[model samples]
Target: MSSSNEKRALSPDPAVAAPVGEVAVSVVEAPVAKKAKIEDDGKTGEEVQTETQEVKIDARDARDHGIARVKAEFRVPKSDYTVTDTVPSRDNDDESELNGREDTSRRQKRERGQNKNRKFGKAHDVIRLCEAIKDGGVCSHGDQCKYEHDLSKYIASKPEDLSGTCPVYEAIGYCPAGVKCRWMYSHWSKESNKSLVDEAKKAAAGREMNRIDRSEQLLLQRKKFPTPKSDLILPYLESVKEDNIARNGGNGGVPMTNEERADNAATYIEAPIKPGEKKRLNYSHAKILSPLTTVGNLPFRRLCREFGANVTYSEMALALPLLQGTKPEWALPRTHTDEIGGFGVQIAAPKPWQAIKATEALVEYCEVSAGGLSEINLNCGCPIDLVYRSGAGSALLDAQTKMLRMLKGMNAVSGEVPITVKLRMGTRDKTPIAKKLVQRLVREGDVAAITLHGRSRQQRYTRLADWQYISETAQIARDTFHEVEDKNKDGPERAPVWFIGNGDCYSWKDWWDAVDNYNVDSVMIARGALIKPWIFEEIDAKQYLDKTATERLEMIKRFAHLGLEHWGSDEYGINNCRRFLCEFLSFSCRYVPVGILETLPPRLQDRPEKWKGRNELETLLGSGDYRDWIKISEMVLGPCHENFEFQPKHKSNAYEQG
Candidate 1:
């Protein structure tokens, strides 16, 4: 029998064991929580079908308060419900359904976009008259071909190439789509009956494999993704499991005493790394970007990198999917060519088995030697309902022992790759447990870094982050790290765990203040980065930039160009680019220009009153309407496809679209 599955000789007395399932919190009946007051338009509210708010503000009072407070206000426009051309509206007959209703449905639902259900376009029955077909051979279909078989007929029907050079062909030397691609004429030479392919690029293509490189294709195809030490670690985990079963009288739900738990953990878990094996990460004062879902793709990370972000993380990949050899999950680890050393791949897993296996796969499939990643981050702070429901994201914060086991298992399997974690304050508002959690993380998790987002899971994005609590927790983390360091003096010299503060960091002032006053190793920006990707630039310069609308447009244009390059310049790619571009604009539009803002440091919670920009483009940039976002994307990506639809992730500011 395997060491892990072997029956223990001595079973512990059942009387001493409690339920091993996480310590269940008592469900006390509590009064219904009252809703917080609406501070901004981003709050939940319906379009006033029978009324519109009219405000009168004194210019002198506005200048004094830094915000225009309502001097006199009344509801107007009681006749018809206003609706945009792009947004669907209720018919006049159905207007009564909207009367006196809470209209919780007004918040826009999340969008998966064109890329989610993408399929390659239909392939021609007979191959086109390319050089390969011209070599006196039948088309790949051989017989029963529907397309024109004669080269002359095919050549005659082909359209002329008006769209300059094929950007993909020019860079890669070969067009994989060949004649089927819309831009075929750009690369094809009718006179020579050949492609004007670059020899150097052709040779380079043969050498590159993987998304980032072509040479690793063989390794990937063979499913050779395995960490060298995974075998050792897997058995150890099994032994731990066996011990737990033996000690708990075969019940996985039976909880052991602290001593019993420690004894089992010590038997299986080794130090995260050897004396010199840990990878050192310099996150101190780093301009770090959060791993924003959907919005944080490779092209966007490249854009952020160009704009001066020192560190960028991939969108969180689920562990089970990664272990199952899923392409989509694997793709999450693919980084930009430029993000060689500071790119981290974040993963979410509920159990040790998933965590360990996924970590092993990442270490094996994406080697740091191949510029695959810098670190593996455990995402424990995501408050999204879907993630939270999976007992992964913020749920890990509630299951402290489960979290510790998962982290230890991940570290053991990840080989040299340092492990980091992102955390929220706690699951509930009344209980802020991050400080206590930090002490536990220091003692058992063996993590290389910890990032604390200063909010409870319940708060999500409703209120401004409590930076004071973040500061307090950071101080606690620092103290705990010192204590752990002193205690582990005789052991391997692992790198000091870096502590980063994340939440509502929109400007250079916010970042610097957190690092300077809160004593955090660094600050991570999420919505702030999406709104103004160049916030890193501002941090580097240590000053707020009064970027003109034209300058901001240039940034958008750069994103469009980069998007086309990364996603490819084909129709499918163009549509995906436009979709993602719109997603970006949804956040980017929230930036109220620094020059026009009354306050020196703009509060993310404050909503601007109806105001025109210094320029038309600036006004367009700050528009809250989702259709305006599509309009801005059209400026660069060209008009979105007729079938295209965009839904902002933020429901609070979304227009009604069914």
Candidate 2:
């Protein structure tokens, strides 16, 4: 038989039955609730009681203990606990439990190293300029040089039948790849062992390909990019020196007095660009795409452009790496010829010096008219753990003073290029500080635009973004900008700083609602753009698009073609396209068929249950498995690498079962 103490131990709350001094331990279990039916009265909707069922307690020894005696005398009332059976249906209950709660611990770790494929063989093992037949110079190493000295030997080694024309040779006139390229036979002549017989010679005559002309190589060679007439470097350095003196003495190395501090402030020089001369970018009513970290490659942005995205941003590049002239980081700023007019390069920096120098280098290398860079945006909203740990990304939200300094320095050095900032609600959840931050940015940041993502760092993607707060903060931005305009009336005329809101804009309806209600200049989309690349088209039509599986497949094929063009049609480029395609599929597969949804304008957070598509193609397109995504990629780009392993960034409905 069980004692009273044993019965009390099962209760969720010990205060209900335990004496003042008695201690009780509770067993945690999934709560069960009695169902309630709603019977709408003609006058009012009300819940009418139908019948009461006996509570089923899973007490193992209830019969032996005669639980009826304990229940009759000292029953734990049902009123003590709130009912949780308000779930409308079992499907909804299941969806609510799974939505935004996916586990991605394994996938996150493997995400960084997945793009490790590189072409084999030494790229530099070719005939040098000094040894070239045209140069008419002999190699100092002679036979000891690793590269082929005889032009005849190099031509004889090439395959008799050529595959295709060398893309690099076709572009720049000379083939830097030289003997290493598989398609060397097509570019090189069968009769002549020289670099080219006709086409290559003509192209080479037009322009010479210098193998040592890489961006990083120039940095290592101590070459500086051209400086603007209105250089800010001197003023910035002087300001830093004055600040150091004010805080920690001038010649004596002691703290200065209040009068000395005032004198320093009075003597400080400002590096402000003349208002009429500063560059401007039009973001108003612009269909802008958010800068995706990995998936937002050049080909993908070009695809978005064709679909209707007007203003596009490059994937975020780190400032330190850009300053060091890293190859991969510099590649981030390279845009396709088609995107030249509307592209903006986004950069991440933790310090003012890093930001200013990186911006200056970018401006010099990629001019507004030539390099496709319309604006420079500072990324302050990245939430990845690595970025935050480096005192960059969302970590800047806590370091507002430093963020302002970085922005101002970047603006001063950018020269004819506008500066922008992307921010989040705040660092922590339920503690929104973007409203106040916007006011400060308007007053001192000198930014051309500000983008506020509606979610905090703590929220990640767990909950739906708070658009209401976004609208409120947007109003604050509008008022603050006006206030700044009034204060600057006596000074140089300034352009209106655009305020763009980003988050959870999945459908045309959501986009319209946000723009109409929030009063923001425009909206920037991230996941929604991936899920449905044609979202901009829908926004124009003001309706939901039900793109068929065949249409979607065609879009994927276009993406592959563009990838081949940008990355190359070679084996390495094909594999690179396949990898990025799979990363894109990680978000694309989450899209539920608009035809199957019972509700209009599907929500981003809604997790659909297991369901089959109308056809095999649709089923495959809607698949959440990374393997299925690979199969889809294979349909367009041939077989995958045997060693290639893919894990989706997020666990989708199909992977949930695993």
Candidate 3:
């Protein structure tokens, strides 16, 4: 009974017919005026027809009409849309429906944090060779050793040698990994089954510095390592604190008894060395690299050094672990020959005693090394929840007196190795306290240098760093230094404290601008260097170098090469290198090609819309996909082992399911 217009409305429109492979069919009844037919009684009648027609709705149109249509080629089935939740799978062919495609949708549930519980599988070798046996020494455990001792059996089951010269052997003239090296074919002699070594070259190679011997580590673990200076300084600091409290009318305003005064006087001891006597450092206009965690391993620091970073700090180490002589924590201070003159060790501690003991131990162990410690930096700026919750890192911002006490004790114990501190603007985003702290640091801290990151603990890389505030604090420090210098004119002259500013420094201009206009001695780069390792080179040249994709790949190859040299060429070492390499790539991928950018001097916060690169290699280098980073790693380190798995520390890189 429907009219012609109604039937036409229900029918598919030819103008908006669906494209190929996207048609939908529907059945409908319509009155079709068939030729008037004569019935048995000779009466004329019209016929009603039922027909099925393809709906022919465009996929785009269907989406507009609240229908989900996912393309086959753009599917990402295993995508993790939120930090804690995986994307739900679709039951039908519409599996490619983009999960959290809208910016708001993506941001609604996304949590900003690091990847948790990442799986880094152990060595692929079922029978790991014993180090003693591999070094041609008898195992301490003899026949009951858990590790494989038979060299022939290990070699028989070893994976095929990687196709390249052993980088470590080439650099140092000896392969420490020996039979276990993935590139063993390059350094091993099949005829004699002996590893080849260039004795002359080996003899000339400079040894890696800051290494603690096993006996020394054991001494520390047994609490037998001597900390004579810390032992004296800790009690002196405690007595000074108590005297200050008593002078301030604490303890019910009770005056010190003669016995108490005598006890305090006996405990008091002067520092063996003074701040004026410490080894002086010149940080003025230096291109420094920040002490990054996770990504700032030894190999990465070496890479940045090659790119012209003048000063580099070790990754932030925990003071308690260092005091305990844990191998992993002790390993952070190990330095390459190239890092000697400009290297610093950064550590975090919750209390003065811990910081003092840790500083004493590091100075005692590492001070005699070639070109000894440039400075020992106390890390008070780290904003991670783990460090903050432990009353360390940025937690010190809320407890200024405790931080100052710790720094003072650290200075007392750290012989000629001068102490420094890295700090944030404040614990909170709105209220900054560094300017006031600068005055106290000049008067009381006796720190050799100060580096202030312009962001607060609460901000946590969410906003642009307040350089104006950093500049204000730097001026305060400068003024305070002058005041201290005037007061100490008749006393032993101390070296001026260097002030370095850090944050959002991504280019040559950023570096020079802070030094020229912001009143900072220098700027320390973190994510900037990770994004472009050659940023220091740019600062020197004062111009941007549009590196070709091949050149970038060469840099990656150099990183892998250096990684193998530092980490070794064993299976475990290769995987370790791969994991860190991927971590580097996760940050590196944020870089947009200068050629593709519509403007000059790319901003670090500017996230470019999806765009193609000039070449496939360039595109791959700029891929957000972690798998592509793995592919890039394979290009340098050879095929990934079957057991190798990598999850990027950042959640942004997990968008691609693979």
lDDT-based ranking:
3, 1, 2
TM-score of each: 0.73, 0.70, 0.82
- RMSD (CA, Å), candidate 3 to true, equals 17.0
Q: For residues 147-207, could you state the per-residue lDDT of candidate 2 as single tens digits?
A: 5566555545443423456654555455544444445665655454445535655544422
Candidate 3 lDDT by residue in tens digits, 214-268: 9999998998989888888788777767776887898765667788888877776
Task: State the lDDT at 109 in candidate 1.
Answer: 40
Instruction: Please provide, for model 1 over 148-201, each residue's C-alpha lDDT reduced to its tens digit, 9 standing for 90 to 100.
Output: 557657656644432556656765676654553446677666676555667788
Q: Please tell me which predicted candidate would have the highest TM-score against the true structure.
A: 3
Q: Please rank every candidate by TM-score, starting with the best.
A: 3, 1, 2
**CA lDDT scores, all candidates in order:** 0.68, 0.66, 0.78
Highest lDDT, which number?
3
Clashes of each: 10, 0, 1
> Model 1: runs farther than 4 Å from truth?
1-86, 89-186, 198-228, 238-276, 650-658
List the RMSD of every prediction in angstroms. Answer: 15.9, 16.9, 17.0
Total clashes in model 2, counting residue pairs 3 or more apart in sequence or in different chains: 0
